[model samples]
Target: MLFFLLLTIIICVLVMFYIKWVKVRSYWAERGVPFDPPNPFLGSLTFLMRKNPSLWMRDIYERHRSRYVGVWLFWRPALVVNTPELARNILVRDSGNFRNKFMTASTSDPIGSLNLLLTKDPAWTGIRKRVSLAFTSSKLKSVQAVAAAKSLDLVTRIHEEGVAEISLRTMFSDYTTDVFSAASLELDSNTTLTGEGAVRDITKEIMEFSLPRGLAWCAIFFWPDMAELFRVNFLPKKSTDFLRRILRAKFKAKSVELNKDPKTVLEILMQMMRKSQDQEKAYSEDCIMAQAAALLVGGYETTSSALTYITYLLAHSPRQQEKLYQELLVAEEKHGHHNMEGVIADCQYIDCVIKEALRMFPPMAWLDRVALHDYKVDDSLTIEAGTPVYVNGVGMQVDPEFYPDPYTFDPERFTAESIPYTYMPFGDGPRICIGKRYAMITLKNAIAAIILNFEVLPCPNSPKPAEAEIQKKGLFLMPGEDLKVKFISRK
Candidate 1:
């Protein structure tokens, strides 16, 4: 009798699972949405561990050629917006209904959960308002000074460490770390020169891609429930602990000095904390530390990856590189070599080059958001509340309909008037990246310094920019391989 009962229970469980699977598989079909068939176990995420998300998004966009494509995040239905019109609607036109992102870190990890990037709703609004104060025009002008000094350091470093042996990504990371540390933390860093420092070590760890770290990031991005259940942290514990220790010490020593004049990013946060009547409620120590940590992670990686790609592309495209060099020469004649702000303000060709590079290799390729209510996607489909939506930014950038010769590296493409709602390397709407201006300045200064000092050439046996391997492990679109280029001194 016991054996018969156990067999009956197993049969019933299997029947229930089959019924649920049928419903899950037929969801997009029933709605008349275009979609690829999902894998039963991993849903539409069979590519998670094997492929890069940006490449996956591009594939989906090309496969459908529709306004949107339906996908599954482990049995949960989601939408990928392909067209710029729909992207605008989701990201900007109806942004109020999509203020919060679907991506989240585990609540158990305060440093990860409480940042401006990951935090949601009322908290995000308040934090964003406060953080905006740190990045005003005057504040960025001060940051430009730091970037200028560091660009000089970068040229010196490249001259000291032969370009043939230097890894572009690692070298750029070192340069970005030093610039971010000096500008945001008011701490001097020699990483750009020596490729070693406490801050540089922390940034290096944050960029490291281990299987566990990659899995943690995947969970945090695509499966928030799993992230919470598994207690995966967005940042490594040791990195956060180091940041806290350094932050606390700095805060303790500089509290009085910053009260008089808060200049740096951290100091600006401290000033906000000082003025807040409800200290714990408004800007708790954890919240303050979280922003600092976010600055480090967001600041270093995006700029470095962008620099790596820009340098690599310039190396391979000699004609375009000459065009840029000629433009830089004109700017140098007008503003002189040391005037970074003047060059950045006036050099149109460099801006085009940067835009083209970002279009080709966006660091964060997709924009994620969740619908607040039953959202009307179109006349045919009204997605249910709590549906995850991803705007395929990089996909649209590379689409032939939008950009002619999309595979080719052409700065002249951006010289023409661009289609509306198409390009967003820094994202769109109110929730766009806060550090956009700072990043642009940093890139401008570094590019000018390098182009003025060295003629970047492709190394022997190195892959072309188009053929470079995209990082399969990390969420961001970074180089999987060590991209190298030979820098011949222009002088």
Candidate 2:
């Protein structure tokens, strides 16, 4: 009698679980939306077999070609916004309902949770508004000075390695690290010339997501419950400690300074903190460190990787390179050769090349947002509140319908009228990259300095367009293989 009772209880529990799982799987199907059947456990993510999620989503986007397609992220149902119309509706028209990003780190992870990139608004709103003031035209120009000095160092480094095959990614990383340290933190990291510093070490560790770190990030971004349950921290403790130490040191050093011109981003942040405190308000040091970490993370890998891609594209397309070279030469002649800023500003073709490269490979594969309320997407579809919405940037940007012969690298395509809602390399709407101007200035300066000093050429090891390797997981689309380029001194 006792054995029979235990068996009956076990059977009832199994039946209840099965019924709940079925209802969860039927979420999108009942809404009249097309969906891929999810795995019993992994859901839509089962398709990912050591593949980059961006490329996987791009495949799904191409197959469905629907305005919106339903999929499951792990056990949770998600919507992939495919068409420009749907994207605009979610990202712009109903932005208020989708203001917060879908991902959040565990609350236990203070360094990872409090960043501007992940922090939800009302807090995000005030922080963004204050930070935006630091990236103003004059402030960016001042930051450009650091980039200019680093570019000179970059040219010197390349000159020393004349016509030798080298990893462009590493070279660019060093340069950007130096510039970020000097411009944002107001420190002479000197990684560009000497190739070693605390800033360089921290940036490397932050971006280098090893297997465990990658899994932690995956849970933090895609499976919030799992992350919270496990208390997963995306930023390693050592890296967090390093950032905090450096920030505290800089803050302490700055406190004693008599002059306060607010030249660098750190200075601006300090001034903001002081003003906030004077008004009888409290701004925690952790919050201040979070913002500084955002700057460091934002400025480190993305710009360097972007510069590497731009160079690779230029090397592959010699005709385009020649055209760009001619444009740069003309700009230098019109303004004196000493005017690096003028040269970077006037090279329209160079700008076009950068835009095209970005279209081909956006830093992040998709733009993510969460529906804060029930957003009526169209007559047929109303995304439920709390659903995850992902705009397939790689899919939309590469679609032949949106761009003619999208695989071909043609800068002329940009000369025509801008493609609405399709070409968001920095993202779109209120949440677009706040440091876009900073990125552009830094990229242009590095590219200009390199092109002026070296003829970027393909090497035996340079990965062809079809052979480009995508990292399995990270904040941005990082290359898995070494980016080799032969630098022939043009001087």
Candidate 3:
């Protein structure tokens, strides 16, 4: 009797496995969805380890243009937006049809769900509204001095700290972190001038999203329960706590200063929060703190990466660097000092150069989204509710069709009129990056200042970017090795 019972249990387990396998198989097949065959578990991402996923996404989209291609993320159906029109529809024109982003995770941890990028709620829109005020034209100008002054110090540091060789990523990180810290949390990062390294370390601590967190994120698609078991959160618990402590302390300090003086992002949010009597429009101090954390995460790495990639591009192309240097010289001569406004405004060629670099290397590899309900790009495709959709932002930027001879770097593509929808360094749509103004200004200022003052050359041992591309393995397309360049200070 016991042996017979064991046999029955074994059959039941096999049947359940068979059922699950059939469901994943039938998910897209039933809808006649055009898609690549998925790996048993890893979905289309099986090749993610070998090739840049953005490249793969772009290739697949281009190959199958005018049709939706269904791929899998570990048995779950993930739709890759192929045509640019469909991409615009899903990302912008009719974005409400796909309101949420498409990353998965176990819902076991509280802090994990606290992030705006990860959470789903009306509160997100509210928070977005409040944060939007921080980066207005006037507000961006308010922080321009901070970014410019910090960059000046960065150039000084670059010259002082062995201008011979240095990591672009580290230096850019120092520059942007200082600007972001002061602007967002109202804290001055001592690392801006001295490279003291503590501020970045603390920020890293807050944002690192350690091994447990990564595993948690990986597990999220497979099962949220596992995320709970692992307590995997993208932001480290200690880091969040530290950020909270720092933000709270700084907010208090800024509050004291605001009583005597002027407006800042922090001061504005505090005033709004304190003055608003409407409960629905209101957020607790903790919510305000969380919003600050989100901004820091979104604003920091992306800006730093853009600066780093620009450094790499300029280092590789000496002729372009010389051209940019002459332009900066011309602008500076007319405006008197290193004029951030005049340079970014009038330097069309420099703008092209920056746009081209952004094309070759986008800060974020892919922009992700989730279908809120069943939707079809056209008659041929109908994605199931909750299917994941990924927009290959960087890959699309470098398409040979859109910009021929894509492998070659040229800045003229952005010159006058081109196809309207092609350029997306800041993404396209309602949910585009919030600090778009600041990001552009900060990038222009840093690049313009550096190009005017220093010449970044390929170091003796430095690896060319295309050959030494970051394993291209992680969420962002990072450099495989430290992008070391010899900074020859200009006369």
Candidate 4:
């Protein structure tokens, strides 16, 4: 009698699960939407651990070729926006309905949860407004010296390390780390020269990926509930603690002279916090440190990865590389070698090459947002509040309809007027990357220095740019293998 009762309970539970699965599997089909048949357990996210999300998104775009595609993140239904018009609407035109990002972190991880990348409004608004002050034209101009110096250091490092022996990502990361540390934190980090420093160590940790770290990021991004339940942290605690210690030291030293003009990015943020305190709407130390950490992570990783891709892409496309070199030569002759102003204002081909590379390999390839209320996606469907939406930035960037021969590394495509909202490597709207100008300045300076000093060539036995391995574990669109290129001295 006992065995029969146990068997009956098991059978009933299985029936309930089967009924639930049927409804879940038919969600998009019921809504008259285009979708791939979801796996019984993983839904549309079977690609999570097996494939890079960016490549997966591109594949989905190619497969459906629809304005929107229905997908499920595990059992939860979500939408992926493919068209530029809808991307523009959700990201900018009607952004109020999608203010917060779908990605989130646990409250236990304040450093992760409070950063500009994950924080929700009205805190997001406050933090963004204050942080905007640090990236203004005049402020970026102040860091020109730092970028110029680091570019020269990069050239020296290449000469010393021998380009064939160097890992493009690591070499560029060192350069970017030095530039950001010196310009933002007022720290004289010599990682670009020695490949080691306290800050550099921190950045290296942040860049290092493992199974656990990958899972944590996956949870934070695709399964926020799991992130909260399991207490996943976006940043390692040791790194954050070290940053806090250094930050406190700097703040104490700076506080001693309150009237001094703010110089570094940290100083600007410190000033903002001081004013907030004066107004009795004080920002906490954790909040300030979170922004500092965000800038550090954003500053080094995105720019370095972009620099890596740009260099590798140029290595394979000699004709385009020559075009860029000529452009840089003209700018150098016109404004001298160290004038970043000339590179920023006059180097058109260089700009085009950078844009093309970013189009092919955007570090943060997807824009994630959640609906605050019932939202009409189109005349055909209305998604309820709390539904997650992903604007596939890379998907549209690679769409052949938008960009002819999207796989080819042609810089000329950008010389023509691009379709509106079709290319947003830095993202779109009010929450777009605040460091875009700073990043451009850094890229322009470094690329000019390298091109003017050395000619990059494709190393033998290496994979082509398009065939390069993408990181399967990382959340960002980064290289999975070492990308090496031969550099011959132009001097």
- lDDT tens per residue, model 3, 299-372: 77878887888888888888888888888888788887756777667777788888888888776647778788
Q: In candidate 2, which residue pairs clash?
A: none
The clash number for model 1 is 0
Instruction: Tell me each candidate's TM-score.
Output: 0.97, 0.95, 0.90, 0.96
**How many backbone clashes can be found in candidate 3?**
4
Pick the winner on TM-score between candidates 1 and 3. Answer: 1
Better of 1 and 3 by lDDT: 1
lDDT of 2: 0.82
Question: Per-residue lDDT tens digits of candidate 4, residues 112-161?
Answer: 88988899999999889878877888788767888988888888988987
Q: If ranked by lDDT, best first, what sequence of candidates would result? A: 1, 4, 2, 3
Note the Cα lDDT for every prediction shown: 0.89, 0.82, 0.70, 0.88
Off by more than 4 A, model 3 = 47-52, 62-66, 104-112, 206-210, 219-231, 256-262, 272-281
For model 2, residues 180-253, the per-residue Cα lDDT tens digits are: 88888888677987778888988778766577887787887788888888898757889889978987788888
Residue pairs in steric clash, candidate 4? none
Which of 1 and 4 is the better model by lDDT?
1
Question: Which run of 10 residues does model 2 get worst, by summed lDDT?
Answer: 255-264
How does candidate 2 fare on TM-score? 0.95
